[model samples]
Target: MIRPKWTPVAWLADRMAVLVLGLIAGFLVGLSFAGDGRILPAATTVASTDGPAPSPVPPAPPVAAQGVDGPIPPQVTARMRRGGVLRVGVFGDSFGNGIWDALYRQLPTSDGYEVLKFAKEATGFTRYRTLDLEKRAYEQLARDPVDAVVISFGANDAQAVYDDGHLYPLMGDGWKRVIGQRVDRFVAAARSTGAVVYWVGLPVIRDPQLDADMQAMDGFYEAHMRRLGVPFVDSRPLTLGADGKYTAYLPDSKTGRPVLMRTGDGLHMIGIGYQRLTSGVAADLRRYAARVRQAAGRPAPTPTGEPR
Candidate 1:
């Protein structure tokens, strides 16, 4: 058999062709292993919205299971059994001032109840950058512990809020969620000290628009407090008449004659108004105290005929 002699250039070219083939085979094997023998299409690019998508609203934390069913803590019952002075902390905006004053004057002193007021006028949780109510309440709790806390706000919260340089209008869902989270934080802070929280809702305001806003805010407060197993007091019905209208005067308990319940500003309450407004709140506190005492197996004190 006769064979043609190969040139060095031809041999080199043949070797290069073999090397190229080997490289192609190796690449195909690697690709098959990477994709598990399945073919994938190229990824498609999607155009985003005009601006950054709004952040997903965070879900509120699950309600604490401890007190949801309304059982008083043993620590609270033990304190009640000690028969020492019971300290109540009143904290919030100016609306709280009248409530605290009325509670201090009317809460049964014979039962060893003392009220400590810590309200700031024209401040709320919405303007947290300016004044954080949760931080303030936490600081106060650290300074002096109280058996219970009374909170009333929203008077100054119905306004625009500047968050991260974005202005959110009042009474919007986003605004309400932010405010609700703040309330949750404050209530949690107060509860951390083993103190019961009583959130008082705002009453009807004179301005129809402001009144509607306040009513909406009250819904937020009530929902949060209920979920947290805290007591919520709605003062609107107390200030409103049977026709669901805001009244400056209602029949006084002492006298059947009409007595002024609201101040000229329509947002504030006069002394007599506060006196009447706080009566129901005082009753709730008394009932709570009684429950604590009863839970501790201690008999509640006999009535001294004190006018709540």
Candidate 2:
């Protein structure tokens, strides 16, 4: 075999060839990276084995559990699962405002209950211009979601009612139907947010005419509550004296003497009166919360942070 003689030109050509090969290798390696120099992971798309994948199964809604108070609201149970407070939103007139404080005091914050005040003074089904109950229910719920709702309305609604270009004069001329529809709408909006609603009826007043009007309103609420299957808290019965009539004073449980329950104006009640007024509701709430915790597989919280 004849061997070629080694020369400067041959050596230079060999070096050039090595340089060209190296440059080509570097160019191929650079192409593997993105323009930003990030190494992209290899990916492959597999063709569908069936006619487009079946729509992803939506999560099942929370099931309602039957409890002593009533059917457990899905929202309430969900909140319990998240270890959140059981929120109670009160909406209506000044009565709602009063009862909110009473309820707040009854249901302690440390016990995992939150009472939100959405009540406004001088606002009712008759007074839509001041505050629209149905609209506000949706808006407020959207802003601060809640699990339970308590609505106290009626005292401020015994006056003139105007709806859809028509004026209703004091509990007459389609007043009951229209106002009942308004109540239904507000409740529907509230229930849409998965909150359980409670309707509070009118209490007995001092004035004869006002008391009669309140009784009539209470009748209306009772009829509607039956139809809607909502709880009707007949405050009149709760506020009645031993004589089975409206009374501003009741025998104090501890003192065994008459205590003034009504305010001087006779339009509202005192703090202790409110406490008594909201006792049933507070008990109902506690029971509902207990049910929620039970359904979520959690135990009741005791003082020592241990389950009861």
Candidate 3:
């Protein structure tokens, strides 16, 4: 049909207008989803919330073993293997002091147990010199629970006089009695902590008479330790050579010759002496553990000479 030209143009314009509107609508819908080309679909977008995040699980607390009066029983081996720290408090004079630094260097860094040392120089058991030493030692024990304690105070106490009208050498008989009582108090202090206590008796000296005094002190210490069921490590024999004399600074066991075991004063041992003393003590500690196990009616753990 031959239609009017203006009518055809108007119809074409109307169709173009509808097409433009449809394109505009499509662009708006696309903008809503894509968000200015920086966003993904609205369905995939997430919004912030006001609630707390999920909490993380915490680790369980350490298990504390029950009180052990004497030795570690056999049944507790599994528990000990689970591994806890071993804090140590050393009470003694120069001799003990040497061992402390040596052990501090020798103890394995990767070992399961941890060792702590508290010491005072030239300190003794008796109140003759200072009660400060005793007070400090007690404070250390109270601060932490230790598995073992080592005592090396007799060297200073061999000539110790009590404040109770007793003196050393000059007061002879009464002096010994008072000194013994003071030692007892010292041992009692450590005993109350439930730690396996090891008393390192004084070593042999160059003077024969000093050796005699040390012997008497050793006897008294051993008796008290046995009475209290504590371990006594008599290092005098280890320090002496086969010649029955205080071995040279670092006496060679096989040759009976002096090695480098002392400082310039020829009285105190150097690092090597400390090494020997600690190794011996470490061995004895293992033995003590075994004895404790047996006493506790459990299978004794094997004794090791090396540090754990």
lDDT for each residue of candidate 3 in 158-208, tens digit (9 for 90 to 100): 453544332334124445455555665666566456666666666666656
lDDT, ranked from best to worst: 2, 1, 3
Instruction: Estimate, for each residue in 66-114, the C-alpha lDDT of model 2 and write its tens digit.
Output: 2245767676688778865688898867677677767877887778788
C-alpha RMSD (angstroms) for model 1? 27.9
TM-score, cand. 1 vs. native: 0.74
Ranking by TM-score: 1, 2, 3
Tell me how many residue pairs clash in candidate 3. Answer: 4
Residue runs of model 1 more than 4 Å from their true location after superposition:
1-54, 61-69, 81-83, 291-304
To one decimal, what is the Cα RMSD in angstroms of model 3 from the true structure? 37.0
Listed in order, each prediction's TM-score against the native is: 0.74, 0.73, 0.60
Predictions in order: lDDT: 0.66, 0.67, 0.52
lDDT-better candidate, 1 vs 3: 1
Worst 10 residues of 1 by lDDT: 33-42
**Best of the candidates, TM-score:** 1
lDDT of 1 by residue, 112-206 (tens): 67688887765777678878888888898888777777788877776645555454556655566567677888888887667767777787887
